[model samples]
Target: MARESFKIFYAGRNDVILYEGVEEVLESLKQKYVLGVITNGNADTKKIGIDHYFDFNISASDINAGKPEPIIFEEALRQSGFRAEEICHVGDHPVNDVEGSSDFGMKSIWFNEKELDWPLDQKPNFKEVNSWSELERTVESF
Candidate 1:
């Protein structure tokens, strides 16, 4: 009963809250590049009402691997049909998103909305953006 109830409640992802400027940023970026989502969570862009902006959505659950793992990144590269160096991954996690994509040979942009200092010992090979407004510029600079 609990499992079913949970599934029912989460069916539409109605509780998913996007940060400010998410739509605007997505709209802007969509105009210039091929947009896709690579997520470890069950965020359905369609359910979240943003599916039209993305060309594809790759989920960790679908492939039995998560970020920081090469498999997930590999899957994204395969789906994108773009060379690793030609792609740029934007995410908030210092290790999983930033380091993972960078190590996979893709350009990375750290969405540091909280302005937190980087927690890793190694210097970041990725660029950092604190606001959605900064995102497009950062990605373009890559």
Candidate 2:
């Protein structure tokens, strides 16, 4: 048998640097909201060095489901002890984050870093944030 070289993608190998002002904004929001993370990616917050900021992290692995589904959001809502209306989920994906949250009866802030137009079909009018600063402002307003 011939040996074949393979590339295995390890989650921790990639850089995990926080965006500028992320820590400060997290620190401020931590004082007000019960911070939680619901991500499709397999990021180790401890390895990323931002685990301290989040009260809880609900990954796909944790719930056997990912975004665009109410299960994960419901789990976070349960953990948060807040009404669905009081919670705001911020995500980059239009359908998964914006539309999904709306469907689940939670507010959403869509992070559109490129300032792209809403895709015609999934044109959700959720609050759009172009930068972390904008996200912080939007979250603070809630």
Candidate 3:
């Protein structure tokens, strides 16, 4: 019963707030590149008020699988009609976002919002950003 209740509560959570300047950066990026979201959690963009900005969204619920697995990344590739080299995935997670995308052949940007150190055993072989401004600059350069 507890597990079922937890599931129900989690499924109802769709209010994901964006960080400062995210909307502006996302809008800017949309003008230049195709933007999509690959999330491991429940993120209803419509409720968050950013649905119009993305080309598509792939969530764990949609695929029945999560990141660090290639299936989700492959699905994004299929839907966007872009080759692995043409796409870049940006996220905060060390393994799920950085290593996962890198292993699958897509470029990755590690958004270390909290200034956390990389895991001791896993050196990031990718770009890292501390803020959305940094990310915007990086993405614009590509």
Instruction: Please provide TM-scores, in order, for all candidate models, with all chains considered together.
Output: 0.92, 0.88, 0.89
Candidate 2 off by > 4 Å: 1-8, 11-14
Candidate 2, residue 59: Cα displacement in angstroms equals: 0.7
lDDT of 1: 0.89
Per-residue CA lDDT of candidate 3, range 41-122, in tens?
Answer: 7857877789899999999789999998999999999989999878999999999999999889988899998999898597
Q: Return the top candidate by TM-score.
A: 1
Model 1 residue pairs with clashes: none
Q: Which 10 successive residues of model 1 have the least lDDT summed?
A: 8-17
Write the residue-wise lDDT of candidate 1 on 1-142 in tens digits. Answer: 9999889877855557888988999999999998889988886788788999998899899999999899999988888899899999999999899999999999999999899998989966889999998998889997
Comparison by lDDT, 1 against 3, better one: 1
Residues 56-122, model 2: lDDT tens digits: 9998888899998889899988888888898999998888889989888888898889998888575
Selected candidate, larger TM-score, 1 vs 2: 1
After TM-score superposition, the amount by which residue 42's alpha carbon in candidate 3 deviates from its true location, in angstroms, is 0.8
Single out the weakest 10-residue window by summed lDDT for candidate 3. 9-18
> Stretches of candidate 1 above 4 Å error?
8-14
Report how far residue 116 has shifted in candidate 3, in Å.
Answer: 0.9
